[model samples]
Target: MALTSIIAIYALFWVMSAFVLLPFGIKTHDEAGLPKVPGQADSAPANFRPGRVLIRATIIAVVLTTLWVLNYTYGWIGVDAINIFEKPEHLKR
Candidate 1:
């Protein structure tokens, strides 16, 4: 539960949030009835608003980081919950 750890976690969440939310509010040139530049990529967005993406990513990262911090604090979901390769204690015998 160190400050650096929290900051790192937040940064990781922020990047993930940004990437996952990137395509959500976007539209291709064709989708938006906009003309494309010469040789532009087919998937380019007509409206690429970095500011909107930034805001949404920030909010998602905050919520996710908070939940992660809470989980770290309370041990609500432990490593064993998702460790599929190893046999649990009761089954080890």
Candidate 2:
């Protein structure tokens, strides 16, 4: 793939990774035994850390992007491997 294509793919993976890890390792004010402000939402995080989330998301995105690049280069998994609309060749008459 071209350099730009790889960069786009990595960016997509990074955003997805960040969203997937958003809810993990989070603690609400109630859970952390911290009193919430009058206007604060009940689900607001008490110790949300963007740095940690970014670091974790970066690591996950790197791993996923590496596998995706390898797969694109090596054809380890192809379109046919995940085609679920039709029966597989082996299962078809």
Candidate 3:
């Protein structure tokens, strides 16, 4: 794949990874035994850590993208492997 395509795929994976990692390692004020400020939502996180989130997202994205690249290189999984709608020759008769 082209460099631009790889970068784009990496960015997509990064964003997805961030969302997947968002709910992990989070603590609500109630969970942390901290008093919530007035108007604070009960489910709001006690703290936001962009740096940690970014680091985790980057790690996940790197692993995912590396696997993707390896699959592309080795053809480990192909379209035929996942074809659900295609009828077998024996069944089609």
Candidate 4:
């Protein structure tokens, strides 16, 4: 029981870190009204790429969570908790 609780806690942390920690590492350009640099044309829109960062971070988080779930559940694919749903047989009932 303790092991299952620990696994749940760890998985929670992993998902939360993916959504929080990873995005925070990315630098978003919020500099509106700032002066344009030399060689920078005023007509050109700022090349802020928050979408790319968000997509990449989401991908990474999904991959990490998938691995964690697979490892914990011994090959289970898309579910969250491991011990509660250990075997395919358990789900049949």
Q: List residue ranges in candidate 1 displaced over 4 A.
A: 86-93
The 10 consecutive residues of candidate 4 with the worst lDDT sum are 22-31
- List the pairs of residues colliding in candidate 4: none
Best model number under TM-score = 2
Cα lDDT tens digits, model 3, 4-93, are 988999999999999999999899999899999999899999977989999999999999999998899899999998888998778998
Question: For residue 55, what is the lDDT in candidate 3?
Answer: 99
- Winner on lDDT between 2 and 3 is 2
Q: How do all models score by TM-score?
A: 0.84, 0.91, 0.88, 0.34
List RMSD in Å for every model shown: 2.2, 1.3, 1.7, 11.2
C-alpha lDDT (0 to 100) for residue 78 of candidate 3: 99
Q: What value of lDDT does candidate 3 attain over all alpha carbons?
A: 0.93
Q: For model 1, which pairs clash?
A: none
Sort by TM-score, best first.
2, 3, 1, 4
- Cα lDDT tens digits, model 1, 41-91, are 999889999999999999999999999999999999998899899988999
**Candidate No. with top lDDT:** 1
- Candidate 1 residue 18 Cα shift, in angstroms, is 0.5
* Local distance difference test, each candidate: 0.95, 0.94, 0.93, 0.57
- Give the Cα error of residue 69 in candidate 3, in Å: 1.3
Residue 36, candidate 4: alpha-carbon lDDT: 67
lDDT of 2 by residue, 1-93 (tens): 999998999999999999999999899999999999999999999999999999999999999999999999999999988988998778888
